[model samples]
Target: MNRLRAVVTEIEGEQNLHIITFDCAGSSLKMMGLDLPKGLHLNSHVILGIKPSHVAIAKHLSGELSYSNQLQATIASIENGKLLSNILLHVKESDVQSFITLSSSKRMNLQVGEQVTLLIKASELFVLEVLDA
Candidate 1:
C-alpha cells in the first residue's frame, strides 16, 4: 500500500506535549507525544519546520486523546464518512506490535479513516513543537 507523509505544522504545550497537527498532503491528524514535566505552558513551544517524519498512522482514531496514555482520532475520508470503520494501521517495518493488543471487536471495528497512534520508541523520532502553524 502507498504511504502518507505529513509535515509537522503545529504544536501545543501543556504539562506535556498537548497536541501536534500535521499536513498530511492536506490530510491531517492530531498526535499527542509526551507529558508535561511539572509546570509547562501549553504555548511554550511553537510548531517546528522540518522534513516530514513518519510520526503516526491513523488507525482506530476516536475523539481527542484523553488518557495521558491514550489517544483518539476522528474518522473522515475523501469519498464518504467512515462511521465506526475498522481502523487500519501501518508502521515502520521494523516496529513491533507484539506488545499491543486489542479486543476482537476492536480489531474488527477498525475501519478506513479511523485512528491509531504511531506508538514507537521515543528515540525513533527527533520531536520538535516550536514555530510554524
Candidate 2:
C-alpha cells in the first residue's frame, strides 16, 4: 500500500455515507466511505492508504474525470516485467507506486522524469491511521 500523510479539511454526507476531503502538501484529495472512525473530525491528522494497482496513470490528460483524487506526479523509476510494470512516482515529497500492464507501460512510453497525472477513486482511499484527535 502507498501511504500519504494528510489533514482533514472538510467532511460531507449524511449518516453512514461520507465524503471526506484532505490536504496533502497543498494537494486536495477526497475519500468516500460508509463509516467514519471514532474521534475523526476536521483538522485531524491522518495517514491515507491505497493499493498500487488501484492507481491509474495518464499522460497529457485533458478535460475532466470522475475520479475524486487527481495528483500531479513525475516518474521516478520504472520496472517492467513480462506481465506487469511497476512505476515509482514522486508526488510532492511522497513516493507513490503504481502497477500497470507492461503493454500499457510501453504504449504510454513512460520514462523517468516524465510528467503524468495519477488518478485514484475516492472509494479506493481509506484512512489507514489517525494521528491526532
Q: For residues 48-133, what per-residue lDDT tens digits would candidate 1 score against the true structure?
A: 22222323333545676432322233333222123322223333222212122235325445454544554322223333443323
Please report the candidate that would top TM-score against the real structure.
2
lDDT of 2 by residue, 1-133 (tens): 9999999999998989999999999999999999897778999999999999999999999998899899999999999999999999999989999999999999999999999999999999999999986
Predicted structure 1: lDDT? 0.37
Q: Which ten residues in a row have the lowest lDDT in candidate 2?
A: 33-42
- Enumerate clash totals for all models, in the order shown: 24, 0
- Models, CA RMSD each: 11.3, 0.7
**TM-score of candidate 1 on Cα atoms, chains taken together:** 0.29
Off by over 4 Å in 1: 1-3, 35-133
TM for every model, in the order presented, reads 0.29, 0.98
Per-residue lDDT, model 2, residue 54, is: 97
Q: What's model 2's lDDT at 23?
A: 97
